[model samples]
Target: MSSCAKADASSSPALEKAALLGREFSLAWLRAAGVSDPEVAVLFDQVILIPAAQHASARFADPSLPRKIVRTIPWSRARDHHLVLAEAAKQQRLAAEVVAEHFEAAHRFDLARAQWMKAGETSCHAGDYKKALRLISRALAIWPWDEAADDRARVLREMARCATNARLTDEARKAWEELADHARDTGKHDLRADALHQLAILSADPVRAGELLAEASKLATRELGPEEAFRHGLAHVDLLVNRVRVAAAKLAFVAVEEAALKSKNPALQSEMLGWKALIAAMAGEAGDATRFVEEGMQIAITHQLPEQVAFAYKRRANIADYAGQYSLEKHSHNVAIRYCRESQTGEEIVCMGCLSYACFRTGDWKEALDTAREVLGQPDLHPGLRAIAGGVRGMIAAFRGEKASAFRHLDEAIRLQRAEGMVGMEFLTLWALAYWHDCQGEGAKACAIYDEIRTLWRESDDLHDSIPGLLFAGAHYADHGRAVQLADCIDIIGEILRKNDLPEARATLLALGAEQARLEGDHEACDKALREAAALQIKAGLPLEQLWIESRHPRAEDHKGVIALATKLGTKPLLARLKGEDCGDSASGLTPRQCEVLSFLATGLTSKEIGDRMGLSTRTVEMHVSRIFERLNCRTRPEAVALAQARGWIKLP
Candidate 1:
């Protein structure tokens, strides 16, 4: 018989005990000899050492082994080791039952504190804050008097704080409160400081929040040294920045400016300084805003925060756009786009929306559309951000004369903004909707929307604001022969322009004069005023407005002026519109299919019904309509049809 059988045969109690102790020693030797744990355990259990062998295997298979040792063991013995019996149960190995039995025995002898601590760490790593808390609580319960228990509890509380920081919902606020209670109970200075900081952030009362953060920062400095204090101070600065941003969006410029100036931290100071520049610009202090923004840009660049740098550039771009510095605006927007795209944050979406608007202002409608499409395509985009993207897309489509598509995007944007309770965007959306109506030749509807926007602005005490809405409304009144109303609107816009010392005010005045002259049938005055407007439009590189003026006159002087400007600008859309060609056709010329589509549009068919007749998708019909609008010097379906009728290209049925 084997040595094992001989050992079992001598079954005296002392001898059996000796045999069991020997088997245990032999297994240790085997483990040191590089035999796998599962194989060695199996070999020992199969040996004929009777109760000695069994007892030896039981001790060897205890799951209470150190983690380092358990981690290296083979799959079979992992099951036999009672330590990971729950995990072993998941395996389908033949030794699963034996492993489970060993696991049950080992669990009875296992320290709950050790298991809870291990589970807490694993859950924290996996971002399961709730599970981590549960495990830490278990550990605390098992060893309530231990220092290690307090440490584990503190770590779990910190994890909960991090999860709460992700979303500032009521549930997160409650979680933060619970974490603070735990921190205070444990008397861990670092944990207490962290809880205090989080409580400040979650506080709805801004004054109280700031006070709490200040105290937390001081406490952290006293307890955890300067580095921890500075980190906490950074959080305080971020909260202030958020509050300032909210104020800015509400047009509470004074509040934003004050808050920014009050921030003591260098980075926070730089950010607030930038916000001051933005508010100044919005308030029509262009020169001061521009100078301040230049300084802010330098500071942002020095600080090396890509988000701040992008924000500064975007603010500069807005200032430039307002001042009619098209080239400078384009440069600023390009820089903003670069910095925003490089940063891995949600702020990039805001930059993209600004860039899209800049592209639209520069008459790069295709670039604007492409950029807006990219922003809207992001899955994690905020609802407010997506609404802005849609608004930009609507503007691009409107500029391209795709009325249906423009309205579709604008409607979607309005829906999103309303859903988000974004009241600040309401006036802007109304302006866009008004412009869409104007494109479709529904002058009355456009004027009504403009009136509503004016009422909103007046009620909000923003009547003196130099928003683009004033310009659009003024132009619309001028177009419709409301000369007196137009003059009043012009005076309001002119006062704002004069206050800001904007050179473009001259062009707007000249346009208003020309419109009044045309209504009065004074060709000479109209011609002189229009000539001055054209000069300013050319100087400012505003081809869209220049094209509009020339399209109305179409005389030698007007046509020549437009062609020269388009040639100098190298703007394809302007050139095509001036030449009475299809905007969608490449320089190579229109295809036969394009001609057929244009013919159908000239007959006044909507794109949707046309798609059904042609057995094409509505998208394809939209593409053809876009092309037709571009070539025909028309910005709407009715205009295209009218132009076609005037040209005798199609009969009005």
Candidate 2:
């Protein structure tokens, strides 16, 4: 409250007449700016004064000088008019009172409004949003006699626009709330619903946001129709769908879809289908996801909205993210970016988040850093987004060997995620932090973090992401002491893997089982598990896993050929412990399968024929032969056969 604005009570009475003259001039000026007498008369009606016919005609012909006002006229609208004139006087560097009188008598109100609004717009364009906001407020408060007294919602909405440009979210939210109240009081359901929709988006609390959106939907349906109802509820449905509240999202989606179908709105229908695909993709229902995504895109092509096209592309990106195809994900995000608007901050931030994750996975560190920093740079970002950005920075920091920076970023992510009740992200951040701790050699700390999430992992929720995280934790848990924990890990994860037919998890489980058996001194069991896991990994055709499994078993790395191959593959960290190791078969207790493979190899059977005979893939057969060579400390099949015969480990026919 500026002192100048607060001291309105003690102004001299003569200032009042200046205001009266200003209002009469404003209405006359409005007529000259394309407003007709009928429009003015109908809107103003009886209570408010209209310019007298003869005087209005006279003023139109030849405007009187502002010196005509010498008597006081007492009215708030009049005082407000004078205030506007005083500012206008200062614009021309004239005496305030003299210009105020001239403004009331001869100056054009239309041009004054245009000039003030243009000044505010220029300030906004220059990024001086605070000054723009203040200037815009000053413009809006400049009262004229022909005011739209019943249309305060529009006024409040304009004020909210100013606050938004200034990045004053709290002010904008309050303005929208007030606007909603005003519209409701005036029985304007459409305006009220729109205001509520804006308020829902501005709210930080998810529960509050959902409530506000729901209210808007209900109000629209009750006062308008199903079409408007869905329009108001669309954002809420998207929010729930993306956040993984499956049941709630499905309910809202169903309602919106039904409304879209009933109203025959292709654009809304297309958007609804896009959301369906996104939800299905998040749930890992790839067939359903793909079908819905295609249907949505075809419909979007027929629609006028660029946003719907962007929605369809974003769903495709989500599917790619789930499939671990980072390149495809990036491509989809780029396409989506083209259709997004400058005002679409939330949508832009989400695409950036996904792009950052894809870049991180594909080892494009520079882009990852750029995208994460871009999200963090957004004005008035949500806490969950903050946590997401911090977590990404942590991973990049760790990769760059900045240990302290990594811990700082990850710790903040974990803390904010937990505080915001972002349960899924909290779990993942904790999982990532544990891996970072292990990488920094804080093994016990890593194990403790695993202890925190092990039970949650067992719940079979979000398994696509949680399974890998838990697998990492399970491996670290084994390092702390696995004899007791191995059975539990195997039992829980094995059942889930089998149910889902997840071969990768199954292979990794087998590898962990091998380590567990070795820890328990069951060398035979250990060798059997390793052999099966290696065969599976080879069938899966993942070179990284093959090298990783070899790293775990030093005997498997004994072959100079494999070491050279691993070196070529840039697997130095996994192969680091392989150097200066014993090349004896002391730990690998060969089983009957290995013996059978040895006999097959001795008979000069190729990998394909060996696989045909043994009911395995050629790659699996190759893996078995490689294991045989490793266990026998040989570099070739013939060498392995000769070593086995010399040791009398196998009998030849």
Candidate 3:
């Protein structure tokens, strides 16, 4: 109906038949469709065909001409041509997807289904998951499930796999659930266990996910070999570890380690050792963590297993982080990222996310921001890693005064991390958001967030989470004069520090103690506590935390080093807060009274009115105004007010 001038009524009948083959059809296909050699030669002479870019012999010169010509023919005639083309394609061994299309056009769906399944499987192997999903869905559409149970089961498995790879979580879950039911009915325990394992991976509800994993592990142990069962056991342990159930993770790891040893797979043993190291590190078992790391590193290096090697290094970094050895943490994470890169296991982004946090802790804000951005830029990054990168980006943005970007990233990080069961990352992001609010003087909002964190900590009763939680929340409460709330957090922190004995934890407790002293107006106690906290923070190598403790010193001149370091780190938020503390000596050289007058000038108040408010004579107010303008090198009151505000010398409100 739609005309390409090249395809008119006068076109050869053989060409019209060839058009049923597709836009592109071979000379041999035309002959096999019963077109004579001379007819093909005549069609070529008429310039109705052209050389195809594909290996096919020849194609219609105007591709649309084929569809037009085919439309002109009756369905019966087209069906015959399609059947012939399908046969020719089968003999020529064309792509299964291509052959399936011809067979479907010929209404031979039984034949089409097999080719479609094959095509889908091929696409899946090629990592074209969306295409594979489409093709498998097509195969399922035409074939009745009970008619061919084996084919149906295979199609469902591939459907779930492709859907998972495409990140269609709901669809993948449904398919896996269906497959699990089918496997159970068929008494295929191994298949059922594998389906359950996949379901656990997609489930967002931690309790339901853990249940599924536990069942999967039992089934794998009962029906599969030791190695397969160990794999499932390790997955369960990993879920527990990620959820901050450290004691439960440790208990689960005992069986997993036994299974790994029974399997006698060196790589699995090494991987198990790595998880042991991480769990031990988190549980404050430093000696056990060190022993596991040594054994894991030796086995991984001996086997030249890059992924296992990376796993060992990442656990070592975890140990360093727990001990407050930030420089070693950064170096170990770098090595882990390097090994991840070499292994090509798609875990480099996750390691980079860890590096970003380490860099942030060490006051390398620029590198942290860059690494976070790079990790976030990956389109297919795992949800947990995405949460990590997003948190880092949000925290850095909050520090640099990008309020909107900070809120957006931080909110998404919390949502995704919680959904992915990354409790540790979720807590960190919440703390960052609360810290951002604190820096903005939104004390109520900051405390509200901290309250939510405390509620979660109470519900989980996870010491691994509580140490950082209580410490950070206490810092916020202290800053905002929430003395009762600060006392509560301090008590919990003191209890945790007694057992953990981590230097960073001790420093945070000391800092909170200083704040408590300041609130009570005990200047000597505050100064002494601050000095101890600052020294501990320095030994722990946490410059940012150390800067905060130093900046809290009542004598601003004594803590000039804090301002200098904050400036060098380009931590704009800290610099802003520190400058506010030392506002008496502004860069503009305006005296405290003169700075006060500059704020009043910005409000368009006359000298007499400002004098009335300050209990000074109009002449004295004018003199302060003149001094402000002279020091600011401004000729007009408006100019002086604007410049002073720009330099953060005063806030009008």
Choose the strongest candidate by TM-score. 3
lDDT of 1 by residue, 458-515 (tens): 4342322234465567656655546677777667656656655554556666776676
Give the count of colliding residue pairs in each prediction: 8, 1, 0
Q: What is the Cα-based lDDT of residue 258 in candidate 1? A: 44
Superposed by TM-score, candidate 2 places the C-alpha of residue 529 at a distance from the truth, in angstroms, of: 4.6
Tell me the TM-score of each prediction against the true structure: 0.52, 0.59, 0.75
List the global CA lDDT of all models: 0.58, 0.62, 0.78
230-312, model 3: which lDDT tens digit per residue? 98988898888788888778777777888889888889899888888888887777888899998999999998888999999
- In candidate 3, stretches whose alpha carbon ends up further than 4 angstroms from where it belongs are 1-108, 118-128, 301-307, 337-349, 377-379, 461-469, 479-481, 581-653
Candidate order, TM-score descending: 3, 2, 1
Query: After TM-score superposition, what is the CA distance of residue 10 in candidate 1 from its true location, in Å?
Result: 47
lDDT score at residue 532, model 1, on the 0-100 scale:
79
Tens digits of per-residue lDDT for model 2 on 192-305? 899988887777676787788888877876787768977876777766643446567677776677777877888878877887887676565668888998899998887656
Candidate 2 vs candidate 3: the lDDT winner is 3
